[model samples]
Target: MDPVDIGLWGVPLAILAGAIRVSTPFLFVSLGECLTERSGRINLGLEGTLIFGAMSGYAIAYETGSPFLGVAAAALAGVVFGLFHGWVCKFKGVNDIAIGIALMLLGTGLAFFFGKPYIQPVAPKLPSISLGGWSDVPQVQAALQVNVLFLFGAVLAVFLWWMFRATRVGLVIRVVGDSSDAARAMGLNADRVRLLSTAAGGAFAGIAGAYLSLYYPGSWNEGVSSGQGLMAVALVIFARWNPINCFWAALLFGGAGALGPALQSVGVSEGYYLFFAAPYVLTLGLLIATSSPERAMQGAPAELSITK
Candidate 1:
């Protein structure tokens, strides 16, 4: 292909590739947060959990020469963090949001502290499926190398969506989230439900971290996660706690993330940082548009302080 043809076709292909690469973390965290929020709780500590997961997953994978094991370790770490958060919030006076922020800080600090040595070494990267193998073009082949986590995230979204509508367990979680009192009347243990849901959410966040460190960027560093975890919370809100909506919203955020680099590659690199900020800006604007003083109060869980 000539330069012009490459620019026109290659750039779009790269953007799509970037979108897929960038969206995996959002997919995991957003869907995880969807579960947590649906259980009538929010865990913002996922930001910290994500970074820690990245660090731990990379470190373990490097040491063991097994990427899957690294992912498992990351999930375990996330579950530990989630359990801590759940335990703390179980107390009557503790604030889940405040705890989430604290956990975020804690998780970040822990990752940085432990990740210093591992930062220098490169670990094995996750394997990608090359669906574009039929194409002879190198660029097409590279663009078609899809991450396994992307497929996992998609399957998880569909499973959760179905579970929420059809499963008794899903019904129980929704009931707990919608009304603890109602759940209690139904003889369901609300605290236990929230605890398990939050922990599972954290595990998902860890898997996201694993994908970041062991796959895309393919290494561990303190700077690996730049607010993707927190942004995912906003994403879940924008998605209205729907796992299916979370999938589309994550892809949108992913596409927004690719805008800067895609523009730069085309020699239109002005306002690079602003392009990087596009996802956050879009997220903020969505939040403002969706939120109404009256309606927020009506739609938000009575226990949630954000709307109140």
Candidate 2:
């Protein structure tokens, strides 16, 4: 009966809420992929990393009574997976993409095998801040309760942008990403840089998984992620590999992801289900529009596989 609940005017409100919730994982995953790609490596197995992190975070939170700790556990798990993937790809004749697919299967199989018992347990949800305190309506209050991780991600994006522009390490990453040979000429360790970047990226992906099970929707299930990890590849391209752009891009993708729910919340049920496909459709359209294999994206890393 709340005025803020499901009215025609509430369509924008529902979208705003849904975008914040759905975009968290996308934001993290895309950022992770952005980092890895900037290091000239591709990690398609992030899908597995995400699901595994979700399962790990949920199970740990259930046992430890701390959602934040669960988030840490998820990041740790993601690091392990990312490092393992990086390690394997370092070997001679190993294809990074192929190994990523294998790792995806491995992570998922492990999560499903181990996460079975934690499915029904109700873990404590992460704490959120009520930014809509001025509103008395329950829906408005719920809609404005922002998660801390999202804020963390926003700050991280800004920091990374600054790092890339000003810091020596950022310069090193950029140089290495642009040309491994140039990095070697400058006495930088290309493989090590890539491995570290890959691991760091995985850590971000892990946080995304944590956000999934410990917060919004708040559950550990096999179906918790709907290919958000894979979609991140396209998102990175859409954002042109800029960390700052990634933030806005994530919100856009999130809005697309929330399109169906937003429409449905306003009682426009017809064809709303199709709107669920909006993210994928948008990605496909972008890829098609930029379909020049010989040309690099405006800000794409020079050594990135896509650029090659």
Candidate 3:
């Protein structure tokens, strides 16, 4: 194929790869947030949790030479963060959003403080699957090197979707999220449910962080996250708190993120910054399209404040 034909053809292929690569973290974090939101709370501190998870995962992997161990440590850190968020929100007159922002700053500061030392080291990377083993082209092989986390995220999405629809625990979470008063009437421990859900959400966010440091970027750095944590909150909203939709929305965001680099590689350099902003632009557009001033006020949770 001619260079032009290759470029044209490769764009779509590259986009597909990028979508898978970039969407993995989004998938994890969004699913986590979906769980948290479904329980009638939001944790904005995922940004910090993500960065911290990256640092913890990278540090553990580097020290033990085990990527799996690193993932476990990262998840532990996420659980801790989630517990902290839950604990704080359980107090009287505490603002969850404000606490979320504070936790974000705290997580970022902690990551920067500890991540400085591990900046230069290399850690074990996650294994990839070669789905295109039959292909002869190097580009095809490279593109086919899929992350294991992506598959896990896919499976988790399907599992969560099923659980939410069919499981008793999922029913409890939905009950708590949709109406805490009803939960109280049913004699369910609303606070405990929220706490557990929040911690699980944080653990998933941490796993997303692990993917960033140990796989995609493959190193620990203060700047490892780059607002993916925050964008994920927006993604959860766009997904309508559905785990299955979170998967597709994450892939879309991932594709938008890859547009700039893909275009640049093909010598389309104009408006590079705009390309970089594609995900955020899409996010804003989707938010505007989905949000209704009247409907949101009527349908939004009484205790939840983001919509207000």
Candidate 4:
């Protein structure tokens, strides 16, 4: 009946909207991670990659006046980082997990150093589809304003799912991930497969970065990532390395992430911190839930460090 009551009632709608908006980055990052894990390698440095891509993408967009160009730059930056990580991990003595962590720090450091200059610039945003156009209510319309990246991610999920089941490249990647020895016996180059997968994964993460700065929360800042990249690792596990499942898992995490803001919109500011904590809570919960009795991931690549 009152403003507070009205706000409270609108919370659900707000959360739904927030979920769609916030889920884009998660979807992209998780998909990228899905790709990497599918290749039997763990890249802990993706957090760094996310940050660097965010910075690089934002800077490029600001300079080029083309948000799409920023996306391209972010993907390129991600490829470079991915290639670096993949190459270093090829040595017999190299540890993928350790290298991943190192890369995380390196990526974050580089992002901060180079991102300082572009923090204040206003970059163009990519177009969005008005999914809620059928609704006359502003809230409904706003809630349904889907970003193009979200659509692309949905398509990617299906494509990857199909790729894994129907394509030679996918088969080779799965073979290399499942058993390096078996792959070698089959004359498949496991290391090469992993390198390319990691690079592709990095490219995915970069696109995610572009989504963040070019669209929602559109800005170049040191704290732009907020662990979306890291949290994606758990999301991938929850999805059991299934590409299609990754999309659903990302949406779930996105809804959880939106919990805090949704409550705030309804004047329910009490325990706001707890609401904001929902995403982290969901991340930990997913990890615990997805772990097997053997303590290995349910559908992880056998060659992954966690399984080893």
Candidate 5:
């Protein structure tokens, strides 16, 4: 069989691998957003947080020679960003969406400026678990090599889902998100709760950034996030703020994202670029289909700014 013909068969294999690899960032970011939105806060600035995390993670990993440290640094940075965003939005007349946009610009700017020095440096990559060892085909083996972060993300989704369903912390967040006045009546600090949730969400976005720079594409670049952070908000909505559903939705987006490159690799060049836009198109479609004000509002937290 011709090499290209063989490559055709590899398309599905490539997509399978790409889905696992690509979906990871989405999973982390969506999970984080899920937490934030669950608390009735919307953070549009996660995109900036994502870029800054990639830059900081790469620089730290390059300096420390430890990818794990880089991940830690990214998480810390995310926490700071999230906290600031939460604090500022707590003020009356301040819009969360506008603040989020500003933060996104700030994060992206800082990342590009600080990350310039690390562009040429090679940082250590995170390790992957070889699940395809049983397969004789190189494609199968490559496709089966899953990253540790992906597994962690999967576990996190389950944990978040369970937390929401069963935990005291989750209950408090839900209450604040549902009605701040009610939360205050219950003696809960609604503002503090949102601040913490937003911070946690930022940490997740940071980890997602670390995964991009230190694992998959494995480098510091301005385009590292490719808007995955921003898109995650939509993913969270598509999942109806359910963590487990976010996991599945992320994988679906990842597969859609991989379709173009996978097809191009198999010599299918016609309109392959469109495949790159598949995730975004799907997001729009999902929103259109599910976005009747009453329907969208049903699952949305009563205190959420978007729904309001």
Candidate 6:
């Protein structure tokens, strides 16, 4: 209750709050990428999908006064993008990576273009659940005001982990990722599996987009994503394609991302800007540590293009 105590705990408390907030998008996007990569494909275009979803969701929510509807629209848009990417990559000589890059550009460009009008409008915002009622400190209360989507993303990570380890659908996706030939021999359609996984992944990204516009910063803008969509791909690698690990990795990235602002909140302005780079630095470090050919191959799906 003391002012000194509040000052002492402010930075860490803010970081904790920021981690919960910032990490939600990362959690959703990374989990989506995890599902896609598990089926032997990657979606760098999720960056585009993310922004587009943000734009679309904001536009719809502004018009309809319903944030949930906006989220659904975003998910549908992501599905369309995913399907297009999947369809294009089905050609024998086509490269999924190249297509992903193109899609990323396409998605971003479209979002910026169509998003121009919605920038000034205020949309319905998502509600948060306060878990810090027992605490008398304002910082504790602020940090504990959790969003519904973050909880959903956490539940999703657990559900994905369970599905991959126990379900028949998961078995099919894994078999297809490991070896197309083996999948074909067992009478599974590898292309269909990958296509669906990619689509589902896009839906996840779209939902993340909605969360951005409807919650957190809670608005539409060109700079809303800040490359978090693309960065999530690296998060997927860091997590080694494990859904549960993806959840933890996202929180780490989130906390790192929150460091700069958290420092600034506590009057540490001298070098606080440098802390903003923590997430990117962590990404590079993780990639370097994990990129050994043997180590990469050990955790990556057999048919994943990066591993090859």
How far in Å is the alpha carbon of 160 misplaced in model 2?
0.9
CA lDDT scores, all candidates in order = 0.88, 0.89, 0.87, 0.88, 0.92, 0.92
- Tens-digit lDDT string for candidate 2 (102-194): 988998999999999999889998998889989788888878889999999999999988988999999999999999999999999988998
lDDT of 2 at 154: 92
Q: Give per-residue lDDT, candidate 6, residue 153.
A: 96
Clashing pairs in 6: none
Of 2 and 5, the candidate ahead on lDDT is 5
lDDT for residue 156 in candidate 6, whole number 0-100? 99
Q: Give per-residue CA lDDT, model 5, range 103-221, as digits (tens).
A: 99999999999999999989999999999788667677778999999999999999999998899988999999999999999999999999999999999999999999999899999
Highest TM-score scorer: 6
Error of 5 at 119 (Å): 1.2
TM-score of model 2 (CA atoms): 0.95
**Which segments of model 5 are wrong by more than 4 Å?**
1-9
lDDT of candidate 3 vs native? 0.87
Q: Candidate 2: global Cα-lDDT?
A: 0.89
Please tell me which model should have the higher lDDT, number 1 or number 5.
5
Error of 2 at 218 (Å): 0.9
Question: What tens-digit string does per-residue lDDT give for candidate 1 at 1-308?
Answer: 42334666766887788888899999999988888888888899999999999999999999999999999999999999988888889889888999999999999999999999999988898998898879777777777789999999999999999998999989998898888899989999988998999899999999999999999888888889879999998888778778998998998898888888887877877788889888889889887877776544444444454644
Residue 46 lDDT in model 1?
98
> Candidate 5, overall lDDT?
0.92
Residue range 231-299, candidate 3, lDDT tens digits: 898888778778998999999999998898788767888998889889889888887876787643343
RMSD of every candidate to native, in Å, equals: 2.0, 1.6, 2.3, 2.2, 1.9, 1.5
Give the alpha carbon lDDT tens digit for every residue of 1-308 in model 4.
Answer: 11233455578888888888888889888888889888999888889998899999999988999999999999999999999999999999899999999999999999999888898878888888998777667777777888898999999999999999999999999999999999999999889999999999999999999888889888888888889999998888888899999999888988998888888886778898888789999989877776667654767789998887
